[model samples]
Target: MDIDRYLGPGHRTAALVTSHGLAVADAAVRLAEAERIHEEKEELAGTLTRRWGTPCHLGLQTVRLRTGTEEIPEPWAGLSLRVGDVYLWQVAEQGRWVALGVADLDPDDEIQLLLVVTDTDPP
Candidate 1:
């Protein structure tokens, strides 16, 4: 499952197409619409959790790393991440990590789920 099909090129992320056949929505919710967006994200997260198993239970974790930094690893090394309030999950079987978060993608703050293929855990 190539993530490029959903997220475009230049993203060194993996795909979360588990044996359960997980699929992500191509469209993102606008972050500016506070309350409504929150509900939408929660609803989406709930759906994902049910199908993808439980997420990494971290009280408060943020992935703060630049695109070209040593702190980042392969599959995520080329990706610029500035995520807070993230929902993380480790797909041990596939040796991959998935994180669902909101990104400030210039024109809009969009909700995105990134699947990173890594042996190590999230930093």
Candidate 2:
């Protein structure tokens, strides 16, 4: 998904779509002013959010998507993909938005496994 051109520039300039779909879906509870409904929504959102995925799974590809840096794996050798802090973004396609969860290098400095979430935006 991070490599999907459908997200950046030609599309909506939003490459990494963060998965806040669950919370977004439960937003109604916030407006409804129902404590029970709100709690349920929160629980549901948390579960779905974790189940979806994280943006960090993109790894080096994320660097390219975020900073236009492709992974080369060359330490101090010209560059090898601009390395930096990880980031998350909300992506949209056909009015459907997704959330790219947090990212970080695993203990091995590799792409950390994560869950990404998706949700439809209200018109």
Give the winner by TM-score.
1
Candidate 2, after superposition: displacement of residue 23 in Å?
24
- Can you write out model 1's per-residue Cα lDDT over 1-123, one digit (the tens) per residue? 445643433224533322111122223323333335445556767887997887874322233334434465433433334234556677677776665643333233333443443455655
User: Per-residue alpha-carbon lDDT of model 2 for 10-81, expressed as tens digits?
Assistant: 222222322323343445532343334334434544664575433221234443453444432212111113
Q: Give the best candidate by lDDT.
A: 1
Cα error, candidate 2, residue 3 (Å):
32
After superposing candidate 2 on the true structure, give the runs of residues whose Cα lies further than 4 Å from its correct spot. Answer: 1-33, 53-95, 98-123
Q: Which regions of candidate 1 deviate over 4 angstroms?
A: 1-34, 57-70, 74-81, 105-120
Candidate 2, residue 31: Cα displacement in angstroms equals 11
Candidate 1 achieves a global lDDT of 0.46
TM-score of each: 0.48, 0.21
Assess candidate 2 and give its lDDT. Answer: 0.31
